[model samples]
Target: MMIKELEKLFVRDLEKLRGELDQYPNEETLWKVVDGISNSGGNLVMHLCGNLQHFIGAVLHDTGYVRQRDFEFNGRMDLNQLNEEIGKTIEVIRSYFKDADSETFDGDYPLEVFGYPMSIGYFLIHLQGHLNYHLGQINYHRRILS
Candidate 1:
């Protein structure tokens, strides 16, 4: 429940997700548009990176991170680029967690992002869950394509 514990879990989960993503045949393979879906693999990767960056920015610096919400619906990125962005996101998130004090997680700092009231701790947990959910989708798409 502590920040340190949460950080470790986050890192572990991130590594697992990245490993799963690495199993995809290629970036172009991921970019292949699935019929009837609004989002492609590239879009999902960007959205995941953006969300992670947004959470870390909010908690670490109180800065608002700009997310291309609509772009996430129609975007294409190379696998190398997506992997690089994901790596950077993981580093930022890990650093934020490492430096976070107990007070950061103790009090309920309500946020209005996502159009819902969320405590700081709850937000972090939600983001982690979101990442896991998308990672599953990415893996499933890979399996389907392969």
Candidate 2:
């Protein structure tokens, strides 16, 4: 049930991310950072994908995903490519949760993210929180830019 709920939220946010991509008149629009804002929607999407893939796929499931943290903020990805990436990210998270049980979720996380020990479930909540935080930013970014 917990994994279902978490996966639902991640799917929702990924949908929203795709919707934001749809709002852009062109791929270049996704790369625009408004005045005083740092990250574009493109960057945010890359960051979100990289973050989840690294934490969930690599660390938790041993999927060996390598995250380019800097490129997440610097890369210029096409809107279509980003949509594909988000779709893949959703699948990765969904697959992980599909086989996950409470014991696995309750076990210690592979890494001490944020310099503190935390359970996988707690870290996942944190990851979802982080996802929503950036989701909000992307929503606002899309609105303001359009």
Candidate 3:
């Protein structure tokens, strides 16, 4: 089914992000920001992870999720912890999708997130794209920091 495919893609992309992030020798370097507009490589990791939580809470549950948008912006985390967080986020997403049906992905399941209407399929695609974009940033940061 489409949900199964999306779940596979999601896991694949997460693995790719993890592999790319693992290339950074020094974890602290992942926290170095190049410009004011861009976040550090590590920040991107946290950003994506936090967004996962938001999506799972908002789209999946409709409520009961508290997102610390500010906390994700503050401080540096150990690479191990960062990886653990990322893994946790991925697990949450996977679990969410496992129970999803075609109707859920086909717009039959409608939800208002941040006051915007979203389809589960659209949200999943958006999350995958978002992760890929940040993965690119992390890769670039690694190259520049090296």
Best candidate according to TM-score:
2
Q: List ranges where model 3 is wrong by over 4 Å.
A: 61-65, 108-115
Q: Looking at model 2, which ten-residue stretch has the lowest summed lDDT? A: 1-10
**Rank list by lDDT:** 2, 3, 1
Question: Please, what is the TM-score per model?
Answer: 0.84, 0.96, 0.85
Q: Give the Å shift of residue 78 in candidate 3.
A: 0.9
- Candidate rank order under TM-score: 2, 3, 1
Give the root-mean-square deviation of each candidate in angstroms.
Answer: 2.3, 1.1, 2.4
Clashing pairs in 1: none
After TM-score superposition, what is the CA distance of residue 83 in candidate 2 from its true location, in Å? 0.6
- Tens digits of per-residue lDDT, candidate 2, 1-146, equal 37788889988988888887898777777899888889999999999999999999888877888899999999878877899889989988988988898888889897887899889999999999999999999988888887
lDDT of each: 0.73, 0.88, 0.76
* Candidate 3, position 76, lDDT: 68
Question: Which residue pairs clash within candidate 2?
Answer: none
Runs of candidate 2 exceeding 4 Å displacement: none
lDDT per residue as tens, model 3, 84-108: 8778777887778867788877673
